[model samples]
Every structure is written in C-alpha cells, then in structure tokens.
Target: MKITSAQAWWVQIPIEADKQHVSDFGRLRTFDSAILRLETDDGLVGWGEGKNAAGSAGDYGTLVHLLNTEFGQRLIGRDPADVTYIWEDFYNGVRAGKARKAGHVMPDLARRGLTVAAISAIDIALWDILGKADGKPVWRLLGGAKSDRLRAYASGGWADKDNIGAQLQSYVDTGGFNGVKMRVGAMDGTPHRSAERVIAARNALGPDVELMVDAHGTYTVSDAKRFAYLVRDCDLAWFEEPVTGDDKIGMAEVRAASHMPISAGESEATRFDFRDLIVGRCVDILQPDPACCGGITEAMRIGTLASSFNLRLAPHLWAGAPCFFAGLHVCAASPASFMVEFSLGANPMIHNLSNDPVTVVDGMVAIPQTPGIGLDMNEAVIEKFAKKG
Candidate 1:
C-alpha cells in the first residue's frame, strides 16, 4: 500500500496546579501535545505524537502544515513499507533548504519543532507500517530479545513537599520498580539547596533505592559539580542533563568531575548530534526520546551507538499516546536500555487514547504482542480531542 495523506492535530491538555508545582525545574506551566496521523491508500492508518513544549502551539502547527502540505507530497505513492528509505529521503530532501535551516537556528533549541516532530511522526508511522507488513509486533520486527517484560522507573517525583516522599514510597510499595527519578534545579536555586532535596529523598527512600536526579539542564557546570558531590554520598543512579544540550564541553567536564553517572541527549535531535556527544565522552548515559530523536528509526541507530560505547539508554518520555508505545517498542528491543520512564501524573489522553491502554503492573511493562505498535488509537477519543487547526 502507498501513503496517501498525512495530517497533524494539536491538542492542549492542562496539568493541575499541584502537579505543575511539583518541580520548579523550568518555566513550563502547562502540558501540550501535537499528534500526527498518516493515512494509506488501502485504508490503514498510523499515528505519532510530535514533541512540543508549553507555548509552542504555533510551532507544532507550522510543523503539521509542512508535513501535510510539503513532506506529505513527497511520501504520496511511496510504499509505506519502505520505512528506512522514506526516512532518509525526507531527512536529505527537506532539511537541505534554507527555510528549514532557518527554522532550526532558534536559540538553545535543537532543530526546528517541525523538522524533528514531523520526521518523528512519519518515522513512527513507517514502523507501524513495517510491523503490519511483517505481521508481527514492532518489538519483534525491531529484533527484540526480551518480549516478556521490561523494567520501568517511577518518573514523576515532583509532587508537593509533603507528597514527594510518599509518592516514591508508593511506587516501591507497588513492587517491581528497579529505581525512581526525582526532579531538581528550580528557581535558580543554589546547588546546596538542591543537594538538601536530594539528601531528603535519599533518606526517605533509604540506601537501597536507586536514586536519579534530573536537573532539567538548569544547572551550570559549577552548580552540577557541587550537587553531584553532595549527592555522591547518597549513591545517585545518574545525574541527568546538568547543563544545556549544546554544552558538550560542559557535560564532558561534569562527567570528569562528578562521581555520579551523567545522562543526557533528551533535547538532542538526530544521530549526528548524539555521535558528537558520544565521541566527546560527554555523558555516561544516553536519554534519546523516540519522539524527538527521529522516532524509532533513528532511536535504534542511537541505541546501537550507545551500546558500542557501553553506555546506558533510558529514553526521555513525557508525552501522549504514540510516544509511549514508540518508546516502549524501542526500549524493549534495545539491549542497552536500563529502564524506561513512566509519569506519575495522569494524562487522560494516555489512559483513553488507545484501545489497549499501556499499563504497568509491579513496575514492569508487558510488551505488546499484537501486530504493529500493538495498540490501536481510540477513534472516539481522537474525535473528541482532534484540533481544528
């Protein structure tokens, strides 16, 4: 079957104030998502989610238009099964122009929203098509070794002060979680203050619980150094995104000075960018987001590179329907994957968007065995939330 049309929908989902206040890591106060839908001639449809942040609705809209109007034209009549070829053509074709480059040149941002998000949606759709074509789950198609179950980490530990410790305890009480991650670096706070928070969390979880700290790239080299040293006594699992995404040198410096394992690349887009960071020895762990890092197609390549270097992959995931499944498939197939992130905060989109909602039992997510991504979109939910734009 050939790809016939591509469309994108932007959905605005608001997070509760208490949830938003869980961590002061960044300026984001609301949660939003850009969902992409691809249609084929034979009536098969595939879905993907675009990576967008607060106040970035316009960017997602532009990306959808570019993909549907421009990139979609390129895919029309192309065999939906040729996932890799289509990805390469789109990468080389659309990214060659000045308009694309201009869009990519935003400060402190990776490539433009459209470039990464649009490609990510299409890449996911291609994987879905490939799974359907082969009559197998995406995990098996990606050569997954362990399909039974994959370990997961409790990702959203940013609840209010009184709830943070209890929230972590709840995850452990549920059983099967190998570890948990907590947010840090809010409001230009000093490393000493951040260290106190980490220490408190460690004490609450006790010495056995594997603790991870995500600075959200909000700390400077010096701040990271101080906090890393302080948390070293606490036995942190890893320190994530201590510095900005572009700061390879800073990340390398942090890696050199810190006792904790450094993890990053969530903000990075393509394989080339990750290659540079890997070659530079900038991070001890790689956190490639399937939605932002060119979807499953490029995530596999990144995972392979991380494996060659003996680096760990724990993908960054905090989006809606398609992103969760795409990430789950990659993490299931990737040998180097240490664990995948699961948000504590609820998103109705995640709960109701799929026919088979992704569920975590005893902290382990079961791999979907059905064909394609192993989950079908709930059309009723989509119809209710589909954006007119």
Candidate 2:
C-alpha cells in the first residue's frame, strides 16, 4: 500500500510520586515516547515509536518534530511494503540511489542520533503496514516464529537495600518470573553500595529465580569490575551495560573480569554499533532497543550478529506498544533470543497507549498473532498524555 499521510506526537505520561523511581536518569517522573502514525492510500494504518532516552523519561519533542515535519512529509506516496529500501533510503539520505546501485551502505554523515531515531519510527511503521497488507503477524513476516511463547523477565527492581528484596519478590510473585533485573551503578553512587543492594535482592529471590543487574552504563570500568566481583556468587543471569558503550575496550575489560555474562546496547544505534560490541568480545548478550536501534530491520541484523557469534539476543523493550510489540516479534523469530524483557513499571506507553498491554503469565509471554504490531491506539491516553509543542 502507498503511504498517503504521516503524523507523530510526543507523549509524556506522568508517573505518580509513589511509583516514581530514582536512577542515573534521576527521578523518573514521566515515561516519554514519540509515536508515529502512518496512513496508507488503501485505508490501512500503522503505528511506530522512537525513543531517545534509554530510561523511562526524556524529551520526545524533537523526535516528534523531526517526524512531523521532514520525515513525515518525505513518507507521502512511498510504498509502505518496501520496508528495507525505505530504511536504506532514510539512512543514505542524498546518496540513496548511489547506495542502492553499489549494493552497500552509503550512509549520510548524520547516520546516528535523532536521524536514526526518526528512521526507526518510519521503519517500524512500514513493517507494520507490510504485515497488515500481507495478512500475517510480524514474526511470520520476519520468518515464522519458533515458539508460541517466550520466557519473560521482570525488568524493574529499584528499591533500597532494606526494601529491594520486597520489590524483587513482588515481581516474581506477580508474574512468577524466573528472572528479574535490578538497577545499580550511578544511582547507588558506589559499586559497593550497588553490590550490597544486589546481595539483598538475591537473598530474597534465592537461587531458583535468576537475578540480573543493570548499571545503565553508569559505572566506570573499575567499578563495574568491582560490582561484578562482589556479586560473583549471586548467580546473576547477566550484568547489563556494566560500563558505558562508549568504552568498548573498558567494557571488554569488565567482561574479562566478570564471572557472569555481560549485556549491553540499549543506547546503541544500528547493526554497526552491535558489530563492534560482538567483535570486541565486550558482551555475551546483545540488547538492542528497537526504538533507538534502527527499528526491526536493524534489530534483526543485530540478532543475526548475535547468533553468528554464539551470543544471545535479548532486545531492550522498555518502550511503548509499537516498539514493545516489535521487540516481541523479533524475540519470537530470532533463534538467538532466549528471553524478552517485561517492564514492571507504571509505563503508560506500554499499557494505556494501546487497547491491550502485553500480559505475562507464569513468566512467559505469547507471541502476538494479530497482523502488524497488534496495537490499536488508545486515543484517550494520547489525549491525556500528548504534549503540545
């Protein structure tokens, strides 16, 4: 189907004070996302999301602005089924024809950041349209799903040493999750402090339930190594983004010193960034946030990179409905994927933004069967949370 129009908006749903959590990103008072809407000439519609902030809260105004103006205008009359070509065109900018002829990427100088984030939304929406047009789920379009369901891990544990146990336990109790991840690093100020809190969480969850820690790339290499050492005996499922992705070598050093698997790339932008991570031996698991990492097209490439290297794929899915559903399809289809992340927070984008928030039962999430990303946009939440710029 040919695209007829495009629109996007910045939605910032405020979090209640009691539900707000402090992190390196500071107190998350709201969950923000840029949502894109694409309408085809044949009456089909698609939705997508782009995320600039790695955590729950950040400004989506500029992302929304980019899509609403330049990118949205450029989308009109394009073939929505030409997902890959459109993605390449967006990436290559002025040299798109040359890149297509050369059969290689001739990307624009502005290949990363907001440019890719905008491309992410466009790419996702295009895939949604393709799925709808083909009368198939995204996973089937990606190459038939391997399982009807995938294991899901509770992805929130932001409590103090005194209450961290209760917080993590509640997640396991609520979803029967076998695995759970907790925040650490900069928010706790010191590696030792973060370690103590993880210890508390582990003691409560016990060895049966797997524990993972996310430093949010906030720790120094040395601090990351220290944190890994302190929690060595905790049987962590993985140590996520122990140090900033900017320091690949330092992250490699942390991996070398750690006793558990290292996971990263929620802050990364394309298959290229993930390529460096895999080659450097920086991590055992790759975590590409579909919203920030060039959408489904690039995320699958990253997943292939993970499989080729004997690594695992566990995409970062702390995002809105479109992004979250996109991740679910990727995980369901990718052979390297062992699990999916379920955000255990009061995230409006994941819940109120759509007709149905994904449900976790006995620590498992079923692959979506509905065509496209399986989201029917909830206009009430949009009206309530949309930020006028």
Question: How badly does each model clash, as a count of residue pairs?
Answer: 1, 0
Number of the predicted model whose lDDT against the real structure is largest: 2
Q: Across residues 85-200, which tens digit of lDDT does each residue of candidate 1 receive?
A: 66665666645354345654222233545677678888997788678777888989888646578888887676544556777878777655759888877543788877777777
Q: List the residue pairs that clash in candidate 1.
A: 22-158
Q: Which stretches of candidate 1 lie over 4 Å from their true place?
A: 16-30, 54-59, 94-113, 160-163
TM-score per candidate: 0.90, 0.98
For 1-389, candidate 2 gives per-residue lDDT tens digits of: 68999999888888889888877888888888998989999999898999898555567788898999899999999999888988999999999999999999999997899999998998888888889898899999999899999999999988999999999999999988999999998989898999999999989988899999999899998888888889888999999998888999999999998779999999999999999999999999999999989999999999999999999999999988989999999998899999999999777678888787578999999888999877777978887878875
**Overall local distance difference test of candidate 1:** 0.76
Model 1: weakest 10-residue lDDT segment is 104-113
- Tell me how far the alpha carbon of residue 295 in candidate 1 is from the true structure, in angstroms, after superposition: 1.0
Stretches off by above 4 angstroms in model 2 are none
Question: What TM-score, to 2 decimals, does candidate 1 have?
Answer: 0.90
RMSD of each: 4.3, 1.0
